[model samples]
Target: MEDCGEHEGTSELKLGTTIIAVEFDGGVVMGSDSRVSAKEAVVNRVMNKLSQVHDKIYCALSGSAADAQTMAEIINYHLDVHSIEVGEDPLVHSAATLVKNMSYKYKEELSAHLIVGGWDRKAGGQVYATLNGILTRQPFAVGGSGSFYIYGYVDAEYKADMSREECQEFVINSLSLAMGRDGSSGGVAYLVTIDSETVEEKCILPAELPTFYDPDTIES
Candidate 1:
């Protein structure tokens, strides 16, 4: 069984089932599968991995479910307080920095991977990831156990200047492909798209698999 959280000197943490984000010409697309597992067993099938911090800012959580939820709540609360005091929402970069700091502070105890992305008034749209206390800005990012499969599709299909529609399709196809191959990943899919002017969200049902027929069964 894989350890989901850090304890004493344990450094390994279970990855979330699947979460992916892609950057396009004007915005970013983030998607996650709704599956949670414990070892070889599926514990929950409707877990949401994507969180909305504000109207414009959002994040995808991967790793221990408890840790991810707790950290998300903490970050949301902090952002809420900051907005109330400053009379405006923080930029996407600032939000990523805040999460990076918190992750670093609790690096020893918490085992959560975060991908933050959103539209910034000054910087337009951006995405960033936090891993083991280090924060990196990425053109595209994938997390969880199925990330390897997701990356395969993304690397082959992603373009530097894809249209918003194209990017959305790419994200959906990548996630569906991942779910099909990764045993630990499957369920409903949640997608969020963020641009300079608006943030849009959509929910996608699991893809239907095609029926396979054996050639040997056919009569000549």
Candidate 2:
């Protein structure tokens, strides 16, 4: 993956990019673009950045593919153990807290950014983000180099009361805009929505670019 930036006072390489999560009326939506880059070169075209930590909990990773993958596996393992011991699935916030605590342990050596979102029976839908070992719960979160483009679209278009379908469209549109403007972001976008009853995922291909119109070319 491309090195977008480095953490302060550390040589830990940060790579991969572009992850977004938003909470809507009835559920939460999270997604990421499929492109993986290294420096100026594209390394993989179909990388999956989103991971299902539990039946309803999902995490999106951005930075250091190895670290991200390892982190997800560790979190998932913990969640699984919790579920088996408690006789119930862990809450979304619990999962986020678990990740935050684990992240702190590797703060100096690992450069990884994560967006965790899910739906819980008692809490409804929730979203959280982590950066430089600091994790915060948010209404929405964006990470990676392409986040600069995503924030603009989200600021203007996102609505907290939107439905699942609307949120999906908004996420696809936001990712498309980012891919168009950010060289490090591209490929198909994958979305996951978690509600009280179920979790759903969809793949949205890049939208077709608008065709230019010329006033002088009119012909009846």
Candidate 3:
């Protein structure tokens, strides 16, 4: 995990993290690990990386914690104003664009990557990824240093026609895989599922995480 940037007011360097978002048949699933680190120390163990942009729209945050959170809050405010002006929920694309614009404008000062997804009247469900000013709509998206460990796994396992249950499982399994290998990602896994009618949030404790390998069989 590389040092991304300094934490809000401290000299500690905010480190790596893991965040993911996947679009399923009926909705979208987003998740992340709860661990927050600074340099070689764990500064926070219960941070919420999945933040709501609107009632149904959400974004998974990575990179500088303060920068990412501040950006999300700003986007949420803008979306709220837009929704009121239009008398309707903001579109997923519009929310993603706002994130992209902010990231691009502050590319020099901010180091954050966001995976935005949700369900709206126009788009039943959508997922978008924004980083370094580039915005892309994807069936699924993954970010952060822990993400480096699971690129092959994601590519091999992802399916465009996955059901809601399958997508949720996929997200949990992916997070567990990365957490197990990446020093910078661990603790409980937080998840959010957004559909047209409702938004559901869940958490998987470390003890409940799936075991990918037999600890007893590993070489000392």
Best by lDDT: 3
Question: Global CA lDDT of candidate 3, please?
Answer: 0.90
- Please identify model 2 stretches exceeding 4 Å from their true place: 1-16, 207-220
**Candidate 2 per-residue lDDT over residues 45-137, each given as its tens digit:** 778789999999998988777777788899999999999999999999988988888788888776677889999887889999876657788
User: What TM-score does structure 3 among the candidates reach?
Assistant: 0.94
Worst ten in a row by lDDT for model 3 = 1-10
Where does candidate 2 have its weakest 10-residue lDDT segment?
206-215
**Model 1: per-residue Cα lDDT at residue 118:** 85
The CA lDDT of each predicted structure is: 0.79, 0.81, 0.90
Clashing pairs in 3: none
Error of 3 at 99 (Å): 0.2
lDDT digits (tens) for residues 98-138 of candidate 3: 99999999988887888999998887899999988899999
TM-score of 2: 0.87
Error of 3 at 67 (Å): 0.3
Model 1: per-residue Cα lDDT over 92-135, one tens digit each? 88788888998999888787888998887777778898887788
Candidates in order, TM-scores: namely 0.87, 0.87, 0.94
